[model samples]
Target chain A: MTSPKDNKSQIWKKDLPKHTFILLVLLLELFPLYMMLQISVKNNVTFNANQWLPITPDKWEWGNFVFGYNLIMPYVANTVFVAVTGTVFTLVFAVFAAYFFARYKMPLSGFLWAVFLLIMLIPGVANIVPLFVLLKNMNLLNTLWALIIVGIAGGQVFAIFILRNFIEDIPKDLFEAAEIDGASHLQQVINVVLPMCAPIIGTLFILEFLGKWNDFLLPLIVLRDQDLFTIGVGLIYLDGEYNKDYGKIMAAFFIASLPLIIIFMFTMKLFVKGLSAGALKG
Target chain B: MAQPISYRKALNEWPLYLLVIPSLVAVLTFSYFPVLSAVYHSFFDWRGGDAKEFIGFDNFTRAFSDEQLRYSFFVIFILVIANVFKMIPSIAVAVLVHRLVSENAQYYYRLLLVLPMIVPGLVTLFIWKFFLDPNFGALNAFLDITGLKTLLIWLDQTFLHWGVFRADAPIAWLSQPKLIIPSLIIWGFPWIGATGVLIFLAGLQSIGTDVYEAAELDGVGPLSKFFYIELPLILTQVRLNLILMVIGTLQGFGLQLLLLGDSGGPEGAGMVPGLWMYNRAFGAGEFGYACAIGLMLFVFILALTWVNNKFIRVQK
Candidate 1:
């Protein structure tokens, strides 16, 4: 093995370059975020003057954020309501479904699992037309429930796929032990499966939340009222309106992004762990 | 492994059925019903409202001969190809991160990489929209500042004969026809997203230290060592990512939809199948035709996925 002293000396040749390269790439990756943050605090005039460099503190336009916050906060509220409700329902259904698949084998088990798995193959882009029609027919056309119900249906899938594997991998005796204590079917799900699978579920929760939060197409199609618009559709509207005002538009983008930032700030560990588990990082 | 619950015993467990039904009904009504409904409507001349006329194979035939649709496929093909090259940077970064001697550096680099992802994807999209704005965009400003715009103009004038880059006017990246696909390709520069890097890193990190030690004993150089050992070892992750990128790139139109509008930029140059489908359904109210386009996309995506699964097994 090489000596630690030699390693320290030659580190300048090899390791230095690697670090510099990584740092450079990291900065590039972070460029958009930098652009968003810097631009958010400037008004139309100052922004018109300098689109590339940071605006000085003297000219910082906190009013842009106030404008953005007033404009999009309702949509933000709508999104939070939709995303949370959608994520919770999606997880509940996914857990129940995954638990069903994992714990038991019935005549229709393969067929049922096939029903779930096959839907994964259907490019969701293809089905949007019909789904839009469906929301209309179901009287969910202009309502937030449209997003909630559809999100529950489409988003549960990856979670179910992951959770099934997880539940199946959980030692069977734990379920048997819970059952001996008179755990009902629901109780076993709550007590036994939930604990063992909490980490995976947390991962699924974040994924579902992010997916719902980012989804604009469904909201665009389903909701007609501007008041009911989610952040995705709302942001598009904001972009259209504020095309001349980069500061306010960037502020809107920054504000729309905060919920997720706050969420991951707490759940970053679980999120990273879950993604790195080689699950539906897609 | 636990024994499978007998069919009879499964029937006895009727209470268990409750858990599966909500999910089942939701899937049936929303997911499966939409597929069935889309298939049914693909053959009709149905508007989004109620008017329907059964026009068997007409939509399909229209799609077959549609020139814009044809152009869209060509554009998507280019995008898919560009995406293949884009996969390299993530792989390279993963390999570099994997090779880092300091654990703390590796951890911090990974943390830095992941931090950008917390930004909502749409927010990122919009920021890029601003970043690509012709007169006001940072890209044009950067090019102007660095004199690359001048160089590009000279090259275009002398050899290329292409007229995209000009010294006087800012390059209209999204609005210009010739630049749309190029803009789409270069939308996310240094496209080393955390999901890609981390997945590849997971695969790379799984490699035992002894393998590297063995390679070191044989005096293997870094480049060949990468090719023969590191690259081959992470083939599974690479293949998985390639398949994902292909499928995603082929099906995606949101970026186009956001950046280029429903008509898909100038001359419809950035139009892909998905955006074409969206245009048909939403723009023209050709729900039936859009469904047909979507089906056609589904078939291609399914075939590619099948081919990837069947023939491209990596040595694990």
Candidate 2:
């Protein structure tokens, strides 16, 4: 019912505030990252003299990256191994458990789901002491397997929660049609349930990967060897050793952050979708 | 109700049970067993060594009477309160982002907001640690350049009457007891993380356009529409976020440990209970006492979660 000119004015009025707010927030969020990048490329002398200046070509010290990479590359590789292995194991177990919970009849299903819910409610900090003891008793301390096993177990509850909901919402007719074609329970799970639940599975995969990759405390406790350190634990060590060397510290931070940033750029939509769906449906 | 199933039916259902066994075993070993162990160890005098004595209720009583533990409780209380207030700005940002008219603009803003999250949390803490360093910190450099350093020192002197800094000296943010908590609170200003905004935006998007159209036809202004419609609809997300923030603050001490170490900074200003528990168990080898502290925190979080559930009923 409005004229085109009036609508145009209203659009301008609405967008001006929105644009200003968004630009301000974007700057605020980017400032720390910009600072980190600037410091990473500066030499020690220049960095000490001018802490706030952006690095020029003459002042840029590419050696900082070399030094940091030499120091922490092994830890980064260790983290990649743990994250991938943990995510695969978590997804495998979660898919089976969620399929069972969602599709098939089981005794004490409600009670078992309640037990999983109780597991979710327990504070993670409470488990650390006992988990440390348990791992030591099993002679798995300082090993990558400890991290992988614990990560899989910790991540399964949330994964199963999401995947169960996703699988349950799949059309019931699909399973019936598969059954009529002589698809066994295992066949239905592999052929129908897995294909239909791919989106949620992908979401859970990224979530679990990110959790394992960025995890600090458990790895700090369980891993004692320098070679076994995750990137997070390595960064703490780097921070301690290079406390006064801002250039090297910032370099370490930048290198440690690169993988996640790359993954996030490619999977931005999925990441957002995963977070929203987890919060809304949880 | 007592009817027996056929063996064939039972055989056919066996795969489903088998499929769930690994997860069951993992949880039973890693999650449930640890919890049981923690509870069992709380009553003992077991350290890391083999020697153990069953000291019933001693650890719990000692924890209750310990002065440092009481101070830690106070510190955690302040942190939780600060975190609760911190959500206001996050919610405001989410509301602003949701109000953007253009879909492309909304998408871009959401992307920018979430982009910061890609930086690992430890990296963020480290960046802040350097950013808040007394000398050569970005914040102090900015303050010096803008002629605000003198003003800040004067304000500190006038309010606290300490005169601890020279006119040219930069403020030691993390080193001073008075400034540590405030520094921690203000570490990430405009504290709207991506998870919070995305969750709030999801809640907002779930509201039907027809509701807003009707409101517009009824001559409701943007503020009224927000308060009467949008805010009410997003309360569910808000409550969920509140519970999460509470649990996170109560259980998380990684930032404190990273920033201040086991000493918890000057005068124990940052000695949260979680960090206390960690230091007691691992640093000092007081495993049983630490377990008692952990169990106490568990009960506190459980009670708070229960209260939130009972009291903060979401609007239909």
Candidate 3:
């Protein structure tokens, strides 16, 4: 907005203080990550010698990554399964619920929509104890299905809320046109709504996926077997074992974060837009 | 808006309910059931099984006098206070990034801020745990390298002595009772949450360029520009983030549970209401008491949110 041609060279100096301050904050923000990467390549001896900085590439030890991979691979798989399954399950339920809410306004339907909206006001913390007991009574304890079921149920409120907004915004003619083409309700949903709300569904999927992935206390309480451990609980156990082996622990940390980072790399644009949208609506 | 259907027509459209039933059933079974059961069970003496006896208000009476539970609230009070200060960095960074002359620089900054978010939150907690390891942790290493350890020792030896920061050993951050709260406070150093910054940035995006130009014409200084223009404009975002953080901190115990154990650090200094509920339920098998605690927290949060809305909304 300023006269850019008048002081083209001054932009750097003008923003120097802001730039320096932001970069300083960024340094602190990224410090732990840098530390994790540095220690991930250093063995015990080298870690002791140079805990201050990363060792040279030639001096780097690669065994930590291999060992970390072998150690946490099962847990990572368990987490990926839970997160993906839960996200899909959440999206499915949410899509159906959202479609009904968006398409109709019968008295009963309106009452039901109010119930769903009120769901947000209920504090989840209060339900933790009873939920645990419910899971227990359902014979769901120590099973990945417990996590998936609970996650799917807990995730419905937000998904339905956001998806309803997206689905309603969609032009009504599309659904009507599909219906005239002899499309059943399900077919209309699949062919018309799904394609139109694909972006929002992607956003919902990523958000719900992250929610399931980072979930700690539920998995910690539900799963008794190390084999059933999600990444969060798995890391806690790994930390207990590898407290001294900073290299392996950091490597495991990196390994656990790999799927999320990869997902983010592909969906960074949607991720940003989604976060902003979430705030605006929230 | 959704189109309206007549009741007679709605009667014929009963099958449409099939689309909504699955999610409704799941939520009712898993979510609503627990909530209703928690309310029902809070008045009974239950051990997380079929055996239960009606205790009326005994659990509530017990929670009112519980020492650890009360102390956990005190601990969270300190944390919530620390978090108010913690929010400053995100706001500042968003403002600074918004002020950047070059759009390209702004994009890179946002990208860099968001990149760290890919590391799951659990991993962040784990890394912070690593960073605070007394022996070889980043904090201690930095202290020693900067000769600040000597300063800490001097402070300990002189008027302000804690005895924990002695010359004989590395500072045990997680173990020391006195340092536990401070350590908790400092867990996410420079706590510029990428999501938080983005939220604030989204708010700042609504500010017009002409506003800044008018301020410049009025000879408004940078600090006043921030205080008078940028901050007030972003107050809604700030208020939203504040409400979220408070509710989050109130319900959160994962950080405490992960860094400090379920017992909540030395002398249980880091214990929070959520963690205490978990400990009581899972640790002591005091399921009834834990439900009471959870209900208590629920009421407390509801009250705080009501207050937040009243306080912030009126100002707006």
List-wise, what DockQ does each model earn?
A: 0.69, 0.56, 0.78
Write out the backbone clash pairs for model 2.
none
What share of the reference contacts survives in each candidate? 0.71, 0.61, 0.77
Which regions of candidate 1 fall more than 4 Å away from where they truly are?
A1-6, A278-282, B314-316
Query: Against the true structure, what is each candidate's TM-score?
Result: 0.96, 0.94, 0.96
Give the lDDT of residue B167 in candidate 2: 78
Give one digit per residue, the lDDT tens place, for model 3 in B16-115.
7899998999899987888788888899898999999999999999998999999999999999999999999999999999988788999999999998
Model 3 CA lDDT for position B147: 96
Task: Tell me the RMSD of model 2 versus the true structure.
Answer: 2.8
lDDT of each: 0.86, 0.85, 0.88
Per-prediction interface RMSD? Answer: 1.7, 3.5, 1.0
TM-score of chain B of each: 0.95, 0.90, 0.94
| Residue A81 displacement (Å), model 1 | 0.9
CAPRI grade, predicted model 3? medium
Which pairs clash (backbone N, Cα, C closer than 3 Å) in model 1?
none
The 10-residue segment with the lowest total lDDT in model 1 chain A: A273-282
lDDT of 1 by residue, A73-186 (tens): 999899999999999999999999988888888568788889888887777767888999888888889999999999999886688888888899989889889889988889
